[model samples]
Target chain A: MKYLPYILKHLRKNWIRTASTIAAMALCIFLIASLQTVLAAFYGTIDTAATDRLITRHRISLAEDLPMAYEARIGAIAGVKRTAKTNWFGGVMGSSGGQPDMRNFFANFAVDAEPYLAMYPEYGLTDADKQAFMQDMRGAIIGPALAEKYGWKIGSTFQLESIIPPYRADKPFEFVVRAIYSVDTQKYPNHARDMMLFHWKYLYEKTGQRAGVGTYSLQIANPSQAAAIAKAVDSTFENSDTQTKTETEAQFVASFLALVGDLGLILNAIGMAVAFTILLVTANTMSMAIRERRTEIAVLKTLGYPSALVLALVLGEALVIGLLGSGLGVLMASTLIGNLGSIPGLQGFGSVAMSAGLAAGMFAVGAAMGLISGLAPAVGAYRANITSMLRQV
Target chain B: MAAVDVQSVRKIYKRDSQEIVVLDGLSLEVPEGEFVALMGPSGSGKTTLLNLIAGIDRPTSGKVIVSGTDLTTLSEGPLAKWRSRNIGFIFQFYNLIPVLTAVENVELPLLLTKLPRKQRRERAMTALKIVGLADRSHHYPRQLSGGQEQRVAIARAVVADPAVLVADEPTGDLDAKSAEEILNLLQTLNSDFKKTIVMVTHDPRAACRAHIERHLDKGVLMTTVERHDVAAPVGAR
Candidate 1:
């Protein structure tokens, strides 16, 4: 601790090199943390899935729709409480050519609003909003992120063109924004905060094409009996034309992620590559710094500093770079995560965040990067022969 | 007892397969409170002998002792501790750490001790005062003149109160006037503080300031001369 000034002064000797090395490290940390946060949001949806809730979908694929009658049969299964129906509207707003550009897209769901809202207590919907949405056939409730994005107020009306073939209206469907829903982004992934949900009956009355629902979300009375109820629900529809697959919400989300490819492996591979690059950069800089100070190091030895202390001083310099660089990077990531909705093209990741545990882990990675990078130079300093080094002077 | 003893010391260097002998069967002794100068040309092994006495290097085949400790027998760790306690070294380059202020450079050797930082700092100031550089304590090496830098180096050397001071060309890099001032400073350290001093220099005038001058040729001691007239403290004359 008493030798800190000596080490600090040495770092300041080449401020440009030191600052660049630290900046490189900070960039690596930011890249790795952002990639890891994306993976966490994907996997976190599974980990935080409701234990007592289950989703029943078509056996062949989620793209195929299931009849609304299936919800009643699933609700009759033992340990089943209630069921809600939902459909992806695939709506594109203000499209001149009637084509869906992803940039102008927000997830819109035609849903049995009461049961769906009851199943997700984390959404924090008010009774007034729910009653107003129930009274008007064209009323709609949008996520706060979507509302802020389009600058929609409670009484504002908008038109959406259906992208799906069967539900495409000759004249665009009009609806009034009844409420802007609130969600705790820290507690839930951004998917819920970046969506709009309206009544499924309105879609049926407007389109006149009853294509049925995409899935049935069932609330189970007991989490322990979820597996049994799922099995019973699947067995009841075994011989039907649209066979159903029932599982806990967690399993459903996990399978959905699996279909999207191995995100965890991809993210980890990127982190390792970035870390290796940063390690080489920092090591090269430290080697150059130490090489330039060979004579001064010899002088220190002549003053009776042991090889061990020399090693410690060199390593301490690298460690400070690592800690400071990573700290700055993580702080930047936290700020970006907090204001994700305001950043264009990053609005979908409004719920992507760095947790306290994940932040601690990132700091450890930075420290490890520093220690590993410093190892070779520190050893060189330790094994330096004082007499030979003095001869260089 | 002799403050320094080199008994039949031989130092050899190996470059590739060639073995070069820098010192062959060298034996020398300096009694307590005596000042000696080693005078020789380049490659005469004067610096090599001084390094041996300061415990910075080991003899190849013989024992070297300083301040009651057999330097040849001590391991690297203990030898460093012994050097810090008993020997102060000055170089022709001044060798003050460029990043540290004058006083900080002087305080470096005391960092090896258990003294509190405040006492170390106070002692460093006193050493700077002795060299007449107390006002320049906050100045770095590059900011000072060559002569002032050497004074700071001298302060650093003696700040630990080592029993012996070993200098290799203490005035080698200074101009004529600065060289004379540095030689006078060394003479005062020896005559007043009673420090056992061994200096290696090619300058005849620097040698004349010491109590005794030993001349070496090709790694062998050839002559010893005593000069009593210039041995008094520089202030007295």
Candidate 2:
């Protein structure tokens, strides 16, 4: 601790190099942290999924819809406690000129509103909002994030154009907002308030009972019986017009992510590459810094500073750079995450803010990188021959 | 007892499978509180002998007993601790840490001890006062003149009150005026403060300040010159 000033002074000896190295570390750490957060969000849904819930979708593909009649049959399954039907609306909100704008795209869904809301206890929906959504056929429940983005209040009417089949009409579908649901961002980092849910019956009736359900979310009585019940549900619809594939909610989310390729591996590869590059950069910087101070180090040894102390001084400088870089990078990441929810394309990631654990993990990684980077030069310092070093010009 | 005793010390270096002997069968002794100057040419191995006496380097196959401790027998760690307690080293270029102020540079050796911070600063200030640079204690090496920096280096060397001071051409880089001041300061440290000084120098004028001068040539002691002893004996102090 008494030698901290000594170490700090050496860091400032070449202030330009030091600052540039720190900046490089910060940028790399920031990139790695952001990549890790996105990866976490993709996998977080699995960790936070309800054990008692299962999702049944078209076995052929998610693009293929399931029969609305499957809901009643699914509800009758032995371990099934409740069931709700839902379909992806793929709605694009209208711009000021009343044209579909892809930038305002959101995951609007037509759902069995009451049963769907009941399945998700994380969404703190009020009784009044539920009743209002139930009483009016055209009433819709929206996520608080989406509502805030469009400034939609209860009873506010808006037009949405469906990009999916059988719902493209000359006149856009109009619906009134009945409730804005809230979710705990910490508890559900991936399931942010970026989707809208309205009565499925309204879409069915408007399409003359032609539109089918996209998925069925089922709450089971026994979580342990989930696999058996899923098998039973799939077997019941085997060889049918639209075969059913059922899985636990966690497996459902994982499969959905898998459809976009191995994102986890890609993210991990990116993180590893960035870390390796920064490690090399930091090691090079430390080596140069240590090399330049050979005479000074020999002097320190001459003054009776032990080899261990010299090694520590070198490592201490690297650690300070690592920590400063990581601290600044994580701060930038958290701030960016705070504003991500308002971005149209990244609304779902709004709630994926940096956790304390994640932040600490980043700092640990930075510290470890610093330590590893300092090893070669620190060993050189530790084994330095004072007389030989002093003899150098 | 002698403050520094080099017993037939031999030092060798190996370069690309060839052996080069820097010092061979060198024997010397300096009594407690005696000031000695070692004079030799570039490759005469005077610095190597000084380093062995200071315990910064071990002899190839001989013993170096400084302040009654056999440096050859001590391992690197204990040798360093022993050096901290018994040897004060001054480099030719006044190699003070560029970042530290004068007092801070002087206070560096004290960091190895368990002394309180306040007492360390006090001792450093006292050492600086002895070097006649008390007012420039807060100035960095770059901010001070060459002579002032040398004085600060001398202060750093003596701050721990080691058993002996070993300087390798202490005023080699300074102008004549600064060199005289440094030589005068070294004389005061030897006479008034009773420090045991062993200085390696090529300049005959600097060697004149010491009580004895030993001339070396190609790793062997060639001659010895005796001067008037200015400082009292250790017992008298």
Candidate 3:
């Protein structure tokens, strides 16, 4: 323990090298932890998806819309308790009326009011808010994150210009905010906090599209019978022109993320590459430090410090640097993600957190990195010939 | 009993299939409290003999018994432990750990003992005071002059109160006045503390401080010359 001061002094002797190595390690660890947290957030959404709900989409592709009539048939299925239809409005809050740039764009879904609220109990809304939303045809429920972002209070009106017209060709679709909804950010972190939903009847009436429904979300009474219910719903529309694919909500979420590419594989590749680069950099740094300290190491041996002690000292120095670098990196990553919640486009996605288990895993990686990087140099010092090393100076 | 016993020791090295003998059947003895110097030219095995006596290296064929323990028989681990307790070494370059302060360097060997931190610190301070460098104890090696660094090294050597002090050209790197000061300090350590000193130097002036001087040539002890300065040996306290 008394040798710690000496070890620290040795590190400080080559301050520039030590600082650069630590900086490199910190940057690598930050990249790794950030990538891992993003991957975990994507998977966490899938993992926490409601198992009692099932989604029925067009079998060919999600872009293909099914008939609105299928919602009634799917709702009448054996175990289904309620059903809701949603259409992706694909609207952009345009540059009109002093709005900011294109970054304010968010998901706007036209959904059936009563049935959608019934199917999604995770979205916590007050009874008064629900009543107001049901009463007004032009009323919209905005996520709390979205409401806070655009400073939209209940009763405030906003317009979304449609990117895919003729929902709004010359005039934007105007919506009065009726409710601010909140969801379990731990589960639906990217969804309920960044989305807006108005009445599907409004879109139907304005666009005069009577039979189009993008997808149907069904809630079943018996969650264990979800597979049977999904199979039955798909079989009902099998031979029809608009074939349907039904899956449990978790599987549906997983498939949706799959469209974004193989997130897990991509993250793993990035992580391995970063770790390998850090290992090389750290190993080189430790090698240089050991090479420079040969005489000091020999002096320690002459002072009756055993070879094992010498090896441990070298390894301990590496461990200290690794821990310092990794700790700073992870803390910075967590802080950045935590504070990103207020950013316009990054609202709900900012809820991605550094879990305790992930932090512990990163710490283990740091320790292993330190030990492995220092191994060759520590071994060299341990087996060094005291006579030869003494002659070096 | 003799403080150092080198009994027919030999040291050899192999360099890429060629055999080299650095020490060939060299033997010597020095009684307790006697100051002895071994003088030889470069590659004459003077430092090799000093290393053997300090138990920092092992002989190829024979025994190096320092203070009654056979160093050649002890394995590496045990030899380190024995050396920590019985031997203190000074090198030509005054090998003080450059990063450590003078006091920290002096307190290093005492860390191997069971002494508490306070006791170790006190002993190190006492050693620095003995070498007249107590005020410079807080300074690092780079902050000190060459002579000051050697004084710190001497303090480090004696801090653990080892039975024998082996010095290999301790004054080799110093100027004339510093060299004389170092020699005087060594003489004080030998006479006042009754430390058994074995120094290796090629300087005749440095060798004159010893009670007995030995000459080595080509890995062999050639002759012993008695110095004019003689004193009765002090028994161990």
Of 1 and 3, which scores higher on TM-score?
A: 3
TM-score of chain A considered alone, across all candidate predictions = 0.89, 0.92, 0.90
Better of 1 and 3 by DockQ: 3
A200-239 in candidate 2: lDDT tens per residue? 9988887778888889999999999999999999998997
DockQ for the candidate 2 complex? 0.71
DockQ ranking of the models: 2, 3, 1
Docking class of 2: medium
Which candidate comes out best when scored by lDDT?
A: 2
Interface RMSD of each: 1.0, 0.9, 1.0
- Candidate with more favorable, higher lDDT: 2 or 3: 2
**Collision pairs in model 2:** none
Per-model lDDT: 0.86, 0.87, 0.85
Q: What TM-score fits each model?
A: 0.89, 0.93, 0.92
Best by DockQ: 2
Quote model 2's TM-score: 0.93
RMSD of 1: 3.3
Looking at candidate 2 chain A, the ten consecutive residues that score lowest on lDDT are: A95-104
Taking the tens digit of each residue's C-alpha lDDT, what string does model 3 give over B15-86?
Answer: 999978989999999999989999988999999999989888888899888899988888888888887888
Give the B-chain TM-score of model 2: 0.96
Worst lDDT window (10 residues) for model 3 chain A?
A96-105
DockQ of each: 0.63, 0.71, 0.67
